[model samples]
Target chain A: MYLHHHPFCPHSRFVRLLLAEYGLEPELVEERVWERRPGFLALNPSGETPVIVEEMAASVPGAFIIAEYLDETRGLALGTHRLLPEDPAGRVEVRRLTQWFNEKMYVESTEPLVRERIHKRYMSREQGGGSPDATSLRMARANLRYHLKYIGWLAKARKWLAGERLSQADLAAAAHLSVADYLGDVPWDEDEHARDWYARIKSRPTFRALLTESIPGMPPSKTYADLDF
Target chain B: MYLHHHPFCPHSRFVRLLLAEYGLEPELVEERVWERRPGFLALNPSGETPVIVEEMAASVPGAFIIAEYLDETRGLALGTHRLLPEDPAGRVEVRRLTQWFNEKMYVESTEPLVRERIHKRYMSREQGGGSPDATSLRMARANLRYHLKYIGWLAKARKWLAGERLSQADLAAAAHLSVADYLGDVPWDEDEHARDWYARIKSRPTFRALLTESIPGMPPSKTYADLDF
Candidate 1:
């Protein structure tokens, strides 16, 4: 299997973490999605990153679908670390929290900050890339605090984000937060419990690849790679 | 079970369809999400609609999560009409298409069009509701055509949107299109195959309630309730 992704994309990073947890190592290819390369567009007409080509040569697009696919296939093979729970109710909670971070938090926080801080520096002028917009950055920061509080509230109530066992919910939240942390945008000091929960997830072996990924023009924050952080 | 929703919200409509398919009828309550009523906010902090309070009184939020919950808990009882395919690859395809309609089509077409046409009239002057934005409507119309063409391409290629049997993918797509159709916004003539596929879905008994729903000052289109359309 081969994975086409952008190093800094949170969705791509989410898929990577899920793959590592499932014990499958796919060949990685970096894709410049903003450029809309014809080859990549042929694979995914939506022009998004984190498209994976299976061994049978079929392309699978979107992070959520890829994560579910891995859990259904490779997850069954491993017989451990199921990203989703067996019970219907458990699955619902996990999926809810997963969407919470991936959809709501992403649209409200991650995308705006990442677009301004990272993508803007690399994109061409015609693509609306220039100096970062101060308003967008400020809005993203404000949104981040609200999200962190919610995460803290969930952490206080459950062993994991969704429940007792680790699931894709944790991975999804970590994926988005990790990207924000790379830019030093996450205010870890604001919520101690949320920070502690993140610390536990950050220490996992599945997160190693993501921690070490270095973008060409923009480097990760000082403590991004520190497990003790 | 009790479902809090709005008449034209696609996500709320998506959950309603899923419930009908699963043989569950939750008492429906219309919510004006823009108003941000405190009581509704307590049920879902995000203040989004389609929050279903189960018989046990647990609040299940989000369309995707609620659908999965119903499928997991009740799918075993009926022992037929599984909205998600059992096979891993087939499940991936179904989920991929589901997200395609729910996320891609929604952001690109439905939300913008609905906000401009319907929601804007209901909103107050201070809340930025007055006249429709011509540019937004035009962009949404153009985006809708592209999405319809994609749907047509998929309909022509597969037995259903996801595969052989009808799945949540079909329902999710229909839910979004139905809302647009209510506004007389869908250009059915542009895509013959997609129109035919929609006609089949629209004829389902599960769609009966949605067709008869009337929103006071904003009734459905002339052909909205016609199965023969």
Candidate 2:
């Protein structure tokens, strides 16, 4: 399998974490989505990263689609360890929270912050790149606090974000938060419950790759890879 | 089943269409998401419409989540008529396109147009509602044309949006576009293929409810409910 992804893209990070948890490694193809390369657009007309092509050449685009596809194809192999629960109710919660992180959180915070802080560095002026927009960044930071609070509330209420089992919800939240944390944008100390939850997930074997994968010029925060933090 | 939704909300419309297709009628609870009612927020923290509470009282929120939940729970009964195909490959396409309409199209066109043309009329000044922002409307209109062209291209190539069988993808696109059409915003003459696809889907028995659902003062366009249009 080949996965077209960007290291700093939160959605790509979410899929990468899922692939690692499933123990199915794909050859990662770094895609500069801003470039809107015709070849990449052919693979995914959306021109978004985190599109995966199976060996049979059927390409699946979007993180949510990939998550369900992988779970359906590979979940049985993992049995009880599958990231998605088998029961419909459990699956609903997993899917809801996954969407929460991927859609809501990404829109309110991650997408803006990443675009301003990370993507701009890689994009050309013609591609709408420039110095980060302070106004957008400020709004995103304010929104991030609200999301972190919600995460803290969720983390405090359950052993895992969704339930007893470590489901996709945890991975989704961790994936997005990791990207924000990498930029030193997450106010980890503001919410201990959220921080504790992050610590637990960050220590997992699957998370190691995310900690190590960094954008060359923009170094991750001092505590980004520090598990104890 | 109880579905908390707003008539003009594209996501809610998508789920409503799906429910009608499955022959399951829901007691629709109209929610003004801008009010942020605590009870509604309890059901869906995002404060978005289209949250469904099943007979068993399982509250499933978000359009995409509700779509998958309904498919998993009711799809088997539909057999060949299931909106999501049985195979993983087919399912992925259905999901990807469903998201394209729900997420991409909503962000680009439907949400902005609806807010500008519909929701703002109902929202109080304190609720951050007023005259539509011209800049946002202009951008959304341009995006809508691009999206319509895309739909036309896809329609020309496939028997249905996703494939030979009618799937969630078609429902999703039609749902969003239907709302745009309601406000007389879609340029149907510009893309005959898209217009033809819309006509076919809009003629379905399941689409009747959508045609009749109208806001208090904002009546649909002259051609909104016309099957031949």
Cα error of candidate 1 at position A120, Å: 2.0
Worst 10 residues of 2 chain B by lDDT: B54-63
* Model 2 per-residue lDDT tens digits across residues A61-171: 988899999988888999888899988899998998898889889999999999999989878999989999999999999999999998899899999999899988999
Native-to-model Cα distance after best TM-score fit, residue A193 in candidate 2, in Å: 2.1
Q: Model 1 over residues B61-91: C-alpha lDDT tens digits? A: 8776776677667766655468887777777
lDDT of 2 at B95: 89
Return the interface RMSD of model 1. Answer: 2.4
Complex DockQ per candidate: 0.60, 0.80
lDDT of 1 by residue, A1-229 (tens): 8999987888988888888888779899998788999999998878998999987746889877787777667666665457898766777678778888888899999999889988988899998799999999999999999999999999989889988888999999999999999999888999988999999999999899999887787788876998888
Pick by TM-score: which candidate is best? 2
Q: For each candidate, what is the lDDT?
A: 0.87, 0.91
